[model samples]
Structure formats: C-alpha cells, structure tokens
Target: MIYRREIDGLRAAAVMPVILFHAGFSFFSGGFIGVDVFFVISGFLITSIILEEMRDGTFSLAAFYERRARRLLPALFLVVLCCLPFAWLWVMPEEFRAFSDSLIATSLSGANFLFWFKSGYFAPEAGEVPLLHIWSLAVEEQYYMFFPLLVMVMWKRKPSWMVAVLVAIACASLVYSEWASRVFPSANFYFLPSRAWEFLAGSICSLVQSKGQKRGSDPLSLLGFGMIAFSVFYFDETSPIPSTLAVVPVIGAMLVLLYARQGTWVSALLSTRVFTMIGQISYSAYLWHQPLFAFARIRSIDPPPLIVMGALACLSLMLAYLSWRFVEQPFRRGERRLLPSTRSLVASVSLVLAAFITFGIYGHDTRGIPWRLPAPIKEFMADNDWSKTCLLEGSSGWDAMPIENCIFNGSHAQTYAILGDSLASSLTPALTKRLDGMNIGLQQITHSFCAPVADVSMVPHQARDCGAFNAAAIEYLVKSKVKTVFLAASWKIFFEQSRYIFNGEEVATSDVGQRLRDAFDKTVGALTSAGIRVIIVYPHPRGDTEIAAKVAKLMHKGTPAPTITIAQDEFLQQSSPSYAYLDDPKDRHVLRVDPAKIFCGREAGRCDLARDGKTFISDKVHFTSAGAEAVADEILVALRQDDIMDGNGVAALSSD
Candidate 1:
C-alpha cells in the first residue's frame, strides 16, 4: 500500500481533540468523536491493505498478524511497562488491582470486555486508570481477528457483492448500536458489535476508491470536513454515541477518504508539513497522552490546575515524539530487533501475556498487595461489606428486599423504615446498633442513586424506573405501617451543580431541582397522610478531598495528620437549597436533622473530617462506621426529645 500524507494529517486531527478533551478542556467536550474518526480511518486503511494483498494473491493471515504486532505492541507495551511504577506508588490497592487486571486484559486483546464490566468510559474512575485508552485498540484488534478471514473467504466473489455484504453488516451493527446505546450504554460504547459499523463505513470507502471512481476537486470534501468539525465541537459526554448521531463523523471520514484526493484543498491541507508530522507521530501520541493525564489526576489531591494539565499535555507530545523517533521507528523498521525472527514476535507476545496473567492473579488473590500499606489504611481502603449487602442496585427494584442480616428486631410490633440512596444505606449500621434489643423492628429499603423523593428521575446513572422504585418503597412503608421514616441522599449533587447527565443527555440542574422539589412535596404529603413521621436528613459537610486516601498518604509519610475540615458556612450555603422546599409553612409531619450541627462545633465554624486521629468520612460524602454511629446517636437523642419515642422505648404514637 502507498503512503498517504493526507491520511497522517487526518490522524493528527483525530488525536489532538482526544488529548485536549481528556485534559478537561470544555471546548473539546465533543472531542471524543476523534475515536470514531480513528475507527473509520482504520477501516479504510486496513481494508485497502487487505484488498491489495488479496488481489496480488499473496495474503497470509500469519504475515498480516505479524505486521499488526510489529505496528502496535512495541509502543503499547512500552507505555504499559512505564506506567507500572507510578501505579504502584500512587494508586490505592483496589485500584492498583484493577489496573493489573486491565494490563492482563490488554495483553490478551480483551481490555474492552474488562472495562465494560468495570465502568462507563466517561466515568470519573476512568480518569484514574492508566490503560483505559487501550480499550479502543482492543476493539480494533478483536475486529481484525475475524475480519481478515471473513474477507479472504469472500475474496473470489464479485466486488459489488462484497461491498454489499459489508454494507449489510454495517447496517445491522448500527441498528444494534442504536438499541444498545439506549438499553446498555456502557456495553454499546465498549463493545465491537456496536462499533463495527464505523469501520465498515471505511471498508465501503476502500471499495469505492478501488473502483477508480473520482469526483475531481468536488466541494463534498469541504462539506465532509464541516460535518466532522460539527461533531468535534458540538458533541459531548451526554451524546448517545455509536448510535445514529455517530453517522456524522463516520460519514465525514468516509467522504474524506473517498473524495479528498490529490488536488483537492482538503487533501492539500491534510498533507501540510505540520499536519503530516503530527499524523506521523499520532500513534505514539495517542499511546502517551492518557497515561500522563491519568497519572497526573491520580497523584493530585484536587483536580490538577488547567495550567499544570496544559504543561502535561505538552510533555506528552514531547514524549510521543521521542518514542516515535526511538521506540516506534526502530521496531517498525526492524533496525533494533527485540526478536531475531518474524515468528519470534509470537513468542515475545506470549511471554508478555503470561507475565501479565500471573500479575493479575497475584493482584487479585492477595487483594491488591495489602502488605504494601499499614493495616489501618488497608482496612479503611477495603470496601465495607455493608455497601454490597445493604445497598440494592440495578433494575431489579424491590425484588432485592428482605436483605438478610439487615432487618433487626423483626418480631417486634413497632417498625421503623429507613429509605433513600446510598447515604440512607450508610445509616443502617448505626440505626441497627441503636435499636438493638429495643423491641423495635427496622425495615431498610435503600438503593444507590435512587433518592426517596417520588417521581424524580436520576440521570445518566440510575434507571428511568428509579421513581417507580421510590414509589414502591413508599407503598411498602405504608403497607407495613412503619411509625417513622428517614430519608437522605447526596442532594447537593442534584440541586447545586450546573448540569447533570440524564437519560444520555445533559440536563440543567435547575430543571432537575424543580422536579426534586415537586417529588419531595408529593412524597411527604403521602407519608404524612398515612400518619407516618418523616425525618429529612440534611446534607453533611463535605469537601473535594478523599479523606481515606489523604489519611493513608499521611500514614505513608510517617507524618502527623494534617487537619481536614470544611467550613461550616460553606457547608450551610451549599446545603441550603436542599432544604428550601421544606420552607412551606403548612408542612407538619416532616422534621429536618442537620448532621453538621452535631458533628462540628458552632465556635469553630468548620467541620473536622478527622476526629482523634481517625478519618470519619470514607470518601467525600459517605460516613465511616464511627461517623455513622455518631450521627445515629444524635438522631436517637432527637427522637426522644421530640417525644416520637416514649421513655419505655415504644413509639409515642402507640397511644394515638
């Protein structure tokens, strides 16, 4: 196959936006479309190469795979190896284990599947994974594994029929992508089945170009650039990508491949020295950028400053240039041989695979090398069992009820209900302890991200039926005739943020806030009408710091812990909106509890996250076991003061 300088320029176009977007630039919100562009480009170039080899009757699957290994593995393995030391030093144990899992998966060309099971591509946790970008490479490699064989089997057929076959498969893949984006978004984004259509678009472009078709200097190439530019500028995290909307950039790339020929201005622009140079190193640049950004994020206490991230982006380019000149060029040209023969490439890959597989097993079996940290830090870092057992997740709704070992004093006549998202779930440990041996039964109904407010939709994360889940919990509470109900959530996230991802779209916080208020009003009204007392737990003091990690870092350094506090005024200001709906003068049965008031001193005007040398909050918001106990003690005191519970521990309502 001939070299296309214009193609290299297109690569530069694809990589820059991705780098910028990952660097947290708002302008590059739709910059992720660059991956889609790369998909189309790969489809075109790889198909073109395969067709040329088939026409010459010299195609061999082994030779094709060897070339792929030579082109991809050297730089990729170099990046992964380089990331190890930093991951060991900076990443916490569980996260490091996940990184090890990704390393093993990447070596086997299965990172896409590993990541699909882990989290969404755009999730905040993805920013901490050094090898997260490898998923795309894995997707491409998986496609090529079967794609070449399928092409060779059809090579003897008429060209038009082959193109028709490609088109048909592309259509089927696109339909699947559209449906999957709605139903299983992470799978749609990470998997090859939903993504193959983009590559097939390029395959069709290759077929058209092979037929010697030409529309000389036509303006369609310019239109193609415009469409790509539109997607790059306008698309965002909320876009249901790889769906029909992805057609814009896929078609744009197709147009460029088919029409941006010699003498066309688009081709001339792409062939410019600067664009060509960046394009030349685009592969190395892509390999280098993510690790640099991810490490920077992982090592920071707060989000790295924009200037610092900008500097890191420049450093990534410099590193990419060096790798391209040293690592990539030598290996591609076989000037510096890592293996003596072509067949040795397989041996080298196998060795690397075995090493990573072993590392993954050790990492998992040892639970992320727990000996690396002090026992206290390791204990703190470990996920509390309550998170899994007490918290209900997914679309199962109320079917996850009757959480064994969760319901306490079940045989007692007096029943108290705890309801809300994970914040409410955190209360279970403390609530169960407080009511122990008190002859009071507890019904805990908790779902992560599903607030107890009725008829409000949680965006991007929760199912659309979250409102239905809340309604069901409410019905269960009423039917069970629970005497008191407690509700909590990370309300600041919903009411204070400027925007939120909802149903694969960004919605204004104001809109969701209004809906929340409406739901809260209706929910409270229903509970009060049913003669059940309602306790609305106000937002707790929180900061941007990860308290557990911060404490661990302090312990690692063998230094006295630094004070971690959030100003009470700031906390109140942030949480004020959470209670605004309760200002209605007619509201009677609902009572509010401010945890900050009990947790922090009025004179200090700040809430301390660490008390007597132990971290109270786990992350930014959820309470630690001790912290929950403290809050629960205060709640019990309030219950007694309000006469909701009598001196004998029976509900005051027993006489009503």
Candidate 2:
C-alpha cells in the first residue's frame, strides 16, 4: 500500500549475510538465518498489499501473478542463462548431471523437492551445484502462489474468524515443524508445510497492523533488530531450522516489521541510502552469489582464499545492480512491450521453460554431455572401480553380502574377510587380486558409511543397521571359522558431523569419539578372543577438494595432467585416532597395515596424490583402481612381515 524504505533496508540485511555465508566466511556462521528474515518480511509485505487491493475491490489473481512473474523470472532466467556456459565448460560429468537436474527442477518450481531427495550426509558433490540456492526461492514462490488465494477466499468471512483460521494454521505448522526438525531435518528445511509458519508470522503482522495495531516504540524495535543480529552471529549450520529456535528471528522480524514505522529509530536507521540501495537490488544480489562462489570452488584446486571469495561476493553485487538495472527493469517495469501483453508474457515464460527443460533432459540423458569433454578426459572419468556389484552398501549389510562368492577360493583352506565402509570397498580390487591364488580365500564384507566399530552410531539414522550388521559379521566370522580379518575405513569421517547418539541419549561427537575408540577396541577384543587374526588398515590420506574433478578440470584446461598432493603431517594430525591404535607398541597382538607408507611419501612430508601424469583418487576421499593397488601393496607388505604368512610366501593363519 505504501513504500517503506526501511523494508528495503531489511531486504539488504537479509541478502548480505546469505551472500557472505555462502562465500564461506567464518564470521557469518549464523548467516543462513537471513533466509528466515526474508520469509517473514515477504509474508508481511505481500499480505499487506493483497489486503489493501482486496479492500479496494481491485485485486485480480491474474494481475497479482503477472506482477510476481515480472518481479522474479527475468533476473532469475538471466542468472541461470549466464551460468550455462561456465557449467558446460567447468562442471565434471557427474556434477553437471546434478546441475541439469536442478535447472529442470527450478524451471518447474520444484528444486526444493529435487534438492531434498539428493541430500545426504556424504553428498560432497552438492557444493558443485550452482542452482542449489534456488530451493529457497521455490519455497517462497510456492507460498506466493498459495497464500493470496487463501486470503481471498477467507476474506468474505467475519474478521475474527479469518484471523482465527490463520492462527490455527500457523500453530499447526509451527508444531509440526518443531517435531519434524528432529526426525526429518532435511525435509523440514526444504518442505513448504514446515516453513509456512514463518510466512504466517508475517501474515499475522500485516493483519494486526492494518487493523490499527499500535506502532512499535524505539526500545521494542531496537530489541527486534538486536535479536535478528544475535541469530545472524550466534546460530550456525548445525542449528535446527524451522524449529522453536527459529522463533527468535521470526519474532525479531515480526517486531521490526510491525513496530519500525516511518519515524521509529529502527526504521530511520534502515532507511539509510546504503541499505535501501542494496535492498532495492536484493533479489538479483541473492540470485548471483551462489553460482559465482560455486564455480570458483569448482575451478580452484584448493578452497579459494577468502579474499578471492570476498571479491566474488562484491562482484555478485555489481552484477546484481547491472542486471537489476538493464534486464530486470525492462522485462518487469517498462512499456510492457518486452512481452506486450499477459498472453505474450505467458507464452515467453512457457517457451523459455521448455528450452531449459529440453537442455536439462539432454544433459541428464546424455550423462552430462560426455561429448563436451575431450576424449582423453572422458577416459579419465571412466568407470575405474574394479567391480561395484560385490560392495554391500546402503541396506545390503551383513545379511546381503555374498561372503562365499566374492572369495578368491572358498573351497581352499582358510577364508579371510575384509570389512569396513566404502573406503574398504575401494581397496578390494587390489586386495582381492593379491589374495586370488594365495591358497587361502579372501571374502568381502564391507558396507559404505557403516562404521566398522561396534555399539555406537548416529542412532535412529536412516542408514543401514550398522551396529547389527557389524555384530552379525563378528558372529558370522566365528561361526564360519574365518581366522583372519582385515579392518579398514575412513575412520575420521563419522566424527566430522556435529551431533551423535549413544546409549539412548543425544550426545556431541566428543562423547561419540570416545565411544568410537572403545567400540573399535571392543571389536578387536571380540575378534582376537575368537582366535581370529586381525589386520587394521590405517586410513589413507584424503584430498581437501574433489581431487578427481580438480584433476580433470586442470587437465581439461591443459595443466599437463600434473601431480596432486596434500600435506602428510596435516592428514596424520587429523587421523590421530587411527594412528594411536596403530602406533601403540604396547598392543602388538592385533596386527596393523599402514596405507600411509604408500600414500604419504616422505618427499617434502606431503602425501603424493598421483603416481604419474594421472591422479589416482577417484573423488575427494575414495581411491581409484591405481590408488587401491598402492594401498593393497602396503597390505601385502604387512602380510609378508606378519607371522600369518607361511614360509612358501602364501598368507595363512600361523596356527593352521
């Protein structure tokens, strides 16, 4: 109904943190709360306008939707269109496939659902997605599409009943969100029902304000602003979004919107030129930052230094201003000649959507357009994992593993087993190859992300029954007369998360860490007591970025297929848990295999990631066939040094 420079200033407030947060600036840890702030502001502002229009009998759903399409689509399509060339040139095949999926989903206003499904604890490839940020916009757009019709239908009711309905819906959604935040955190984050309460908070604000609710005083508005600032600084990625914790920022925004009227101190401050200007271009600013940062990350071998990211953040704003000036304005505000009429605008939108959908289908169907890469790069990206079929990952744990089949020779004397997560699976080809004709058999019992340790996990998690599976393996090994077992995994990967569950209580990883160590010790004790020889393969060095993609990008850009490496000392420092067990001279009964002897070369104290022109790491942490062979050689050397080896050079139980 009326322009509020303060509202524009608040938009500036919301957008800046989101930009900085995505840029990986540490100080902006709670910066993700900015989206919550925007949700509240949008609900308030949009509801306020709809109510004003309906009161004047001038609200047309078509006009309302046209304005929304005008306000949003031009800048959005422009951003996605600009990202296409870079995505074609830079994104690796797998990541490009995901990018195409997001492009299609965004065009359909369903990116949130697509992203929700793709999310997982181990989804490292997600960072490469430039369209990842569009999930929020989808949530917002869904609200815009639904809420106006809701208000229009309900407007004919008595005032009190209308307010009551809004209140009931908000309460139900808020209650549901709180519960879902614990059980379905990812879905809660992306789903509309869980996030609807935030919009309702603002909707209630508009209703009360239009009914002559008193303007907020200086103290109240200032407190509102302070709460917003607190969430921005104090919250973090671990914070449960849309839960009761979100009430802090939601109420903060509600207060600022309701109380910070024209002359109020908070309003005066927000009305400043700098904030208003950024706020004016905030939509475009929000759209531009993610692609810039993601592409920069995709290109760099290392995490881009903050200064470079900082420069890119600033560049996003400059581009935002330019597009806001030239592209967004002409399509949204000018003589209407760009589309000329609503029919033409709808046609143009549908055609553009079809084009993106076709492109996405092509990219996805063609496996991220393999033709885009040079033939040699395609060779580098080829399926290098020796055999994926035998890996007992996902729900296929102890029961699903075909123990007797994967073995080199089950009919031979003793059958040994290798057990752990995907890291262990990655090492299997070489290990199985080495053990093929060793007179004894080698079996695979590995499952991806299933911790090798016993008695602990992120409980109630949607993963395979790791504790049950591991316990079964122990029982199976004893029952099957398996005398030797190889234990390996990316040990530190589990503790990288924020929260864990142990002993029926919610606990921090600090508690989980101790339980992990104890669990491993308990597992070893169980095995050794059964007269089974155990070889614990220490974790290999992990690259900081997606090593395979980084290598491919470099080679694709003519970097000569160079050697890639990471600091050995740094890797060991992070891997102290595995080292502590392996390094202990006091415990010599349980044998150990150190992969670092092969992966972490002594040259300059850095772990060499490549043996020749080709990098061996398949991704950030998993090994390619060559890398697996290197680690397997270390395991072979350890076998040679162990008493398990017979004098004839075949590995066996010394007792046998």
Candidate 3:
C-alpha cells in the first residue's frame, strides 16, 4: 500500500479540533466530530490494505495482527505507563481505582464497554478521566477483530453481492444508532454497534475505488471539505450524533477519499508541509492530549484559566512529536528491535497484560490504596451513608406496586410520605428515625433527578420517565391517604440556568421554570383537596467548592484549613424565584420549611461549608449525615411550631 500525504493532512484536520475542544475552547463545541472523522479514515485505509492483500493472494491473519500490534501498542503502552506515577501522586483513592480499572480494560480492548457503564462521554467528570479517549480505539479494534474474517469469506464473490451485503450491514447499524441515540445515548456514543456505520461508510468508499470508480470532480472535493467544516463548526454536545446528522461528515470523508486525487485543490492543500507533519504525529497527539489536560484539571483547585490550558495543548503537541519520532517510528521500522520477532512481541504483550492485571487486582482489593493518605482525609473522602441502599434507582417508570423496602414500618396503620429527587432521599435517614420513634409510619417515594412536580419534564440527563414517576408518586400519596407529603429538590438548577439540553436541543430555562411552577401549583392543589398537608422544604445552601474533597486535599497537603464559603446574598438571589412560588402564607394546607436560614444565617453573611472541623456539604448540594440531621431538626421545630405535631413530638393525626 502506498502512503497518501493528503490522508495525513486530513488526520491533522481531525485531531486539532478535538484537542482545542478538550482544552476548554468554547468556540469549538462540535470538535468531538473529529472522532467520527478518524473512524472513517481508519476504515478506508484498513479495508484498502486488506483488499489489496486478498487480490494478491497473500493475506495472512497473523501478519495483519502483527502489523496492528506493532503500529498501536508501543505508544499506547508508553502513555499508560507514564500516567501511573502521576496518578499515584495526585489522584484520590476512588478515582485511582477507576483509572486502574481503565488500564486493564484498555489493554483488553474493552475500554468502550467499561465507560459505557460508568458515564456519558460529555459528562462533567469525564474531564477527570485520563484514558477516556481510548474508548474510540477500542471500538475500532473490536470491529477489526471480526471484520477481516468476514471480508475474507466474502472476497471470492461477485462485486455487486459484496456491496449489497456491506450496505445492508451499514444500514442496520445506522438505524440502530438513530434509535439508540434517543434512548440509550451513552451506550450509542461509546459502543461499536451504533458506530459501525461510520467505518462501513469508509469501507464502501474503499470497495468503490477498488471497482474502478471514476475520480470525484474537483467541485466535489471542495464540497466535501465544506461539509466537514460545517459539522466541525456547527455541531455541539446537544446534537443527536451517530444518527442521520452524522452522515454529513461520513459522506464528506468518503468524498475526499474518492474525489480528492493528485493535483486537486483539496489534495494539494492537505499535502502541504504543516498539515502533513501534524497528520504524521496525529495518533501520538490524540494519546498525549487527554492525560495532560486531565492531570492539569485534577491538580488545580479551580478550573484552569484559558491561557494555562492553551499552553498545555502546545506542550501535548511537542510531546506527541517526540513520541512519534522516537517511540512510534523506531518500533515501526524495527530499528529499536523492541519486537524484532513475533515471539518477542507476544512475550512483551503478555508481560504488559500480567502487569496491568496484577495492578488492577491490587487496586481493587486495597480499595484505591487508601493507606496512601492520612486517616482524616480518607474519612472525608468516603461517600455519604445515604447512598448505600436508601436511594431508589434503576427503574425509569414507576412500579405497578411499591417495593416493600420503599415503605418503612409496613405493619403500622398510619403512614406519611416523603417525596422528590435525591434531596428527599438524603433526608430519609433522619426523617425515618424520627418517625419510627414516634410510632408513625413513613413511606419514601424518591426518584433521582425527578422532581415531585406534576406534568413537568426535566432535561435529557435525567431519566426519561421522570414526568411519569412524579405522576405516580402523586397518585400514590392521594390514594394511600398519607397524612403529610414532604417535597425537596435542587430547584435552582432548573430555574436559574439560561438554558438546558432537552431531547438533544436547547430549551429556555424560563419555559422550564414556568412549567415547574404550573406543576407545583397543580400538585399542591390536588394534595390539599385530598385533605393532606404539604411541607415544602427549601433547598440547602450550595458552595462553589466540593467541600469534602477540598478538605481532604488540604489535610493531605498539611496546610491550614481555608474557609469554604458561599455568599448568602447570592444564594437568596438565585433561589428567590423558587421560594416565592412554594412559600404562600395564604394557602392553609401548605407549610413552608426554610432550612437555608439554619444552614446560612445573615449574621454569618456567608454560608460556611464546614462547621467545628467537620464538612457540612458532602458534595455541592446534598448534605452529609450530620447536615441532614441538622436540617431535620429544623423541620421538626417547624412542624411543632405550626401545630402539625404535638408537644410530645408525635403526629397530630385526625384519627388520634
């Protein structure tokens, strides 16, 4: 197979946007499309090579795999090995364990599956993952594992039959991708089944070229360039990718491969010195960029400034160039003699495999090596107790009948319900204990990210059946004749933002807020009409710092604790709309509980995240056990003062 200078230039085009986007440049929001571009290019080149080998009757699976190992493993292994020391020095125990898991997964070509279970590609914590980009490589490698054999079996057939088969497969993949992007989006993004069509698009191009198709016109080449540029600039995180919209870039890449021949403007420009050079080191550049940016984020107290991130991008390119020159080229040419024989290559791979497997076991068994940090820091880093089993998860729609565990003191005659998102779930530990002691039964009906509002839908990041979940909870509360319903959520998240991503498009926050307000009114009216009391719990104070993690970092550094705070004025200003809607003194059945006053007093001027050497806010919003207890105390006081509970702290039930 001959080298194509223009293909290398195209590689440069694919990589730079990804690096810039990951570096926090807001303008290149659609830079993630670069991965799609890479998939197409890989398919075209690999298929071209395979088809040529088959034509010459020299195709051998062993030779193909050996070449693949030589090309991919050296630089990848180096990158992972370089990450270890820094990971030990900086990463927390939980994250380090996750990193170790990724190391093993990447080695086995299963990183894509691992991440699919863990998180979405564009999630907030994704930036903290150094090896997240390896998912794409895993996808391609997994495809190649079966693709070559299939091609070999079909190579003897007529050209038309082969094309039809390939087209059929690609069409099935595209249809699945479209449906999955709407339903199981993270899996669609990370997994190969939904993404195989992009590669097949390139494979089709290779097949066409092999059948003596005419070169695409110069105008077609220019049009292909425009389409790719349009996608790079216009698409964003909200785009429903791997769907029909993705066909634009896939077709663009196909056009370039088929049409942009020698002397064409697209070919001449791509074959330029600068583009060709970056393309040459593109693989190393992709590998190097993520770790540098991720580590920088991990070490920083706040998000690194644009200038700092920009400098790190430059540093990644420099390192990539060095890696390509020394590590990648030497091994490819066998000049370094690292894998001079097939047996040596196998031995090296086995050693790497054993090392990563051992490390993974150690990390998993030791629980991220907690002994590395001081006891205080370790304790601080531990997850909140409420996350263990109290939170309801997994089901998107409401159960036909409530799970037995969801109802506490099932034998008791009188029941009260607690409802909302995780905020309400966190209050369970304190609320259940108090109610149990008083011989009053409690039923917890909480869904994560599902606000207990009627007929309102949250953003796509939440569960799809959130509106249904909320409706079911409301119906259950009314039908079961619960004495009181407690409502809680991170209300400001919906009302304060300018916009949110919903069903793969941006919707105005104001519209969502109005919907929430309408739902709140209808829900409250229904509950009150059914003769149940409604207690609307206001949101707790949130801070910019992740208090527990910051405290742990401070202890690790042996530095004096710095005060973590959020301005009371800012909190009030942001949450005022929610408070105004929920807190209506004129409504006889509705009682409002303001825990913010207890959490953030005006005398203090700002909310203090830590009290008496203990962190209060476990994460940004949800409370620690102690914090939950404090808020529950405030609720208890409010209930007694409002005559909803007796002097003995038992519920003032009508039956009693």
Candidate 4:
C-alpha cells in the first residue's frame, strides 16, 4: 500500500482544530469533530492494510498485534513517562490518584471504560488527568483487536454478506447510542459499543474499493466536503455529539476519503505537505496537547490568555516532533527485528503486567501507603468519620431519605430541614462531624444539582423534568415547617449559562443564580417570618483547581500541621470574578462566609496550603473532602455556636 500524502493532509486538518479548541479558542467550537475525522481516517488506513494482508494469505493475528504494538506503544509509553513528574508536581492528591487510575486504565487498553465511568473528555474535571486522551486510543485499539478477526472469519465464507452484517451492527449501535445519550449518557458517550459504528463505516468504505463502487458524480464529493467544512465552522458544543447528528461528519469524511482521489479540488487541498505533516504526527500531537493546555490553565490560576495558549501550541508541536522521531519512527519501521511470535509474547505479557501494577497503585488512597498528618493539625483534621454522614454523589441510600426527616439533628433534634444544592451536600462531611459531636441526629434532604431558588426564571431548557424538579424542590422547601434551615449552593453556576446538548438538540441557558435569587429572598424572608431560624452560609472562595490537589500537597510535604493557609484576597482576585454574577446587593438575608482565609491564607494572597503551587478546586467549583474540611473548620464554628445571630455580625436573632 502506497503512503497517501493526502491522508496526512487530512490528518493535519483533523488535529489542528482539536488542539485549537482545547486551547480555549472559541472560534473552533466544532473542532471536537476532529476526533470523528481521525476515526474515519483510521478506519480507512487500518482496514486497507488488513485487507491487503488478507488477500495475500499473510494476515497472521500474531503479526497483526506485533505491528500494532510496535506502531503504537513506544510513543505512548514515552508520553506516559514524561507526564509522571508533571503529575506529581502539579496534580493534587485526588487528581494524582485519578491520574494513577487513568494510567492503569490506559496501560491495559481499558481507558474507554475508565473514561466512561469518569465522564466525557470535555468535562472540566477530566482536563486534570493527563491520560484522558488514551480513551480514543482504547477505542481504536478495541476496534483493531476484533475487527480484523471478524473480517477474516467472514471474508471467504460470505464476502458480500459481511458488509450487511457490519452495517446492521453499526445501525444498531447508532440507535443504542442515541437512546443511551438520554438515559445513561456517561456510559453511552465513553464506551466502544456506542462509538464502534464510526469505525465500521470507514471499514465499509475500505471494503468497497474506489474502483468498484459508484463514484457518484464530482458534485457529490463537493457537497460532502462543503458539509464537513460547514460542520467544523458552525456546530458548537450544544450540538448533540456523536449521536445521529454525528452522521454529518462521518458521511462527509467518507465522501472526502472516497472522492478525494478522483480529481476533486477539496481532495487536492487536503493532500498538501503542510496538511500531511500535521497528519503524520497527529497521534502524538493529540496525546501531548491536552496535558499542556490543562497544565497551563492550572498554573496560570486563570484561563490561559491567547498569547500563552499560542506558546502551548508551539510547545505541543515540538513535543510531537520529538515523540515521532524517537519513539514512533524507531519501533514501527520493520528492520532486522525480532520475530513476530517473540514480539507478540513480550508485548502481551508486558501489557498485562502494566495493568496489574497500575490497578495495584490506584486501588487505595495513596496506594494504601500510610503517612502522618502533622501533629497539632492532625488532631484538628482527625476524629471526623468521612462517610458516616456525608453522602457520596452516587452512593447508595443517599436520595432515599423521607422528606419529613430532612432536618439537621445536632440540637433539640426532632424537627427537620434541608439546605443548598450539590455544594451544600459536599458540606455533609463537615456538618456530620459537628452534628455528631453535639449528639444530634439530622436528616439531610437534598437534590444533586438543583438549588432551592424562590422564583421560576429559568434559562430555558428542553428538560422540562429538571426545570419542574427545581420548581417542586422550591415549593417543598417553602412549605416545610422545619424549625431551622441551612442554605448553600455553587452560586457561581446559577448565573452562568452553559452551552450543552439535550437528547440530540442544541440548548443553552443561563446559570441558575438570577432565576433563583428571588426565591432565595422569599424563602429566607418566609422562614424568618415563621420564627424558624434560617441560615445562609455564604459560598466559600472559588479556586481554579481541585480541592483534593491542595490537600494532597499538604499531605505529601510531610507537614500535617494546619499552620499554613491560602490568602482569601488572592483567590478572590483570581477566581471570584468568574463567580461574581451571583453577588447581588438586593439579597440581604444571605450570610457571608469566607473560608478562603481559614484554609489558604497564612501569607498575604499566597496560599502555601498545598505542598505544590497547584490550585485546589477540582474542575472549577467543587471541593474535595480536604478542601471542604478546611472551609468547614472556619465556618463550622460560626454555624455550631450560633455566632452569626442574624444575617450579619450584628445581634439580630437573640438566643432567647
């Protein structure tokens, strides 16, 4: 098989935009489609080789796997090796653990499963793990593992019938993906079964050689190319991804791959040297780009400016070149090399060992390694059972609590109350700690993402059920006769609108803050009027990184002492603006709490809180257990003692 420069150009076309999109350039919103583009190209290339081998009666499974290992593993292993220090130095404990888990997953070609359980590649938390890109490799590798054997089995038996079988499978997977996108979105999005059709489509293209099939007129290719280009430019994240809508890019890629050779200008353009170079190292480039962008974003403690992002692009290209030269080129080129059988045995055993080692490392926190939490600080942070009261997001029995029992129980504890949204629930560890100390039994009634805002101004969503649930929660909160109430939420998320898809449709809506403010005011007013003590725990300072990372830093330094703290002002200066939309002057009943000073503020604006300089907020807003405790230690005093007698420091509510 001849090397197609045009294919390389196609590779360049596919990778550049994905790099740009990840770098925060909003212009290439649809640049994510680059993965789909790569998928199509891979199917064509790999299938072409397999078919060639099949025709010559030389397609041995052993040789096929050896070729795959030699072509893929070296560069990948190098990338993983390079990331170790960066991960240790920059990633917090929780993130480090996640990275370790992903490392194990990637080594074993089970990254697709890991990522499916973890969430989408675009999820904010996902950017922290360096091994995230391996999911794609896993998908492709899974395809290679079985696709060739399936083709081999069918090739002689029913050459024509195989296409129908594959097409049927692809169609079925598409239908399953579309449904799963609604029901089990994470599973559907990350798993190979849902994504297999894209590769299979390309396989179909390879099976039907260009000379044998209908070229369909020159106009068809033009239309296909135009559709693909249009998709790259016009589609945004809100577009239902890789569902039925994915057909546009897949079909367009198929068209371009099919017709590009037949003198079409689009094909000629894609065949250029510049494009070919981009394609040549597309794999390494893809692998390196995400970690670079993610690290830069973490270090800046802010989103990367355009200039910094540009520098990252240059850095990525250099890394890609280095990887391609040293790692990729050497092993892939068949030289005076080991026999295929020998290579296969070595590769298989090594992969299996890598999997076992990785799993062992990630199976426990700190890989089950024990270390001390600093003396005085250890006492402060100790004595809290993390799981007894605080509920894990997907933990069993969390949401099953009866509505009547939704009150905090540490005091004269028969009455019930619930407060806040997801952020509030995170505080359960801290809340449970204090409540347990007081010997009070409290029932926590909570919703995962919905906050109990007082009004009905929504950002307009297609999920009427979610919007209705928000409404129902508010009504329930307002009507419930609990003696005391607590309020919390990621106030930042409420005001900001995220552009995402819902069941194959594009939908964008404002954050929940504005829509929720009125209800907040009314709820507080009503609770206070009813003579029920109501408390609004003002949000803690937002950080740019995961909370676990910060705690991990402290843990790793061999200093378990709580002497060091991050500055409230510095964190606010850097991250509060992103969340400032929730700060409305009209809402006076809301109490304010700034735990940023408690956990991160020993120095002026410089938090030596973490062993490293990495920020500690996971993704953008949620806190890990360590982060939540740091804040809880500061605010819990005020909460438990009733020091905040009223909305402010002034004595508005009497102990009488």
Q: Best candidate, lDDT-wise?
A: 2
TM-score of each: 0.80, 0.86, 0.81, 0.69
Better of 2 and 3 by lDDT: 2
Tens digit of per-residue lDDT, candidate 4, span 1-656: 76656678778878888888877788888888888888888888888888888788888887788778777777777777777667656554445567777777787789989887766767766655667778889988998888888888888799768779989988998898888776566677677788888888888888786337635446767776776777788888777667888889889888877777736677677777677777888888998988887766554444669888988987998899888977787666668443335656476649755764564375345732222333432332232112223322222333333444344553554443545566777666566565566564455655555454543322333222333344454455556655556666666555444532222343455443343454455656666666555555555566444444344444445544323344666656654643453344233343345554454545555654443422234434555466666665655555545643545532222111
lDDT of each: 0.79, 0.80, 0.80, 0.63
By TM-score, how accurate is candidate 2?
0.86
Model 1: per-residue Cα lDDT over 89-173, one tens digit each: 7777767778878888888899999999887789876787898999999999998998888798788656548988999999999
**Candidate 3 on 321-401: residue-level lDDT in tens?**
999988888778845556788998899888998898789778877868877766667766774324433466546435764
Candidate 2: tens digits of C-alpha lDDT, residues 1-656: 87889989999989999899888887988888899999999899889989999889999999999988988999999999999999998888878988999999999999999999887412455555799989999999999889988998898666567778888999999999999998788899999999999999999999998889856588889889999999998998888988999999899998898888878999998999999999999999999999998899898766789999999999999999999998888887656547869999999999999999999999999878877888888878774323454667545534644464667667777778987777878877777777765776778887667667665555435433666667777777766678888888777776465665554455776666566667667888788778777887776788766666777887888887577888888988888866764444223446666667776765868987765555668876678888887777777666766754443532321110
Clashes (backbone N, CA, C under 3 Å), per candidate, total 0, 1, 0, 34
Q: lDDT at 364 for candidate 2?
A: 96
Order candidates by lDDT, high to low: 2, 3, 1, 4
What's every prediction's RMSD, in angstroms? Answer: 5.7, 4.4, 5.8, 7.6
- Segments of candidate 4 deviating more than 4 angstroms: 182-184, 214-218, 338-356, 359-364, 367-544, 547-656
Cα error, residue 317 of model 3, in Å, equals 1.7
Cα error, residue 68 of model 1, in Å, equals 1.7
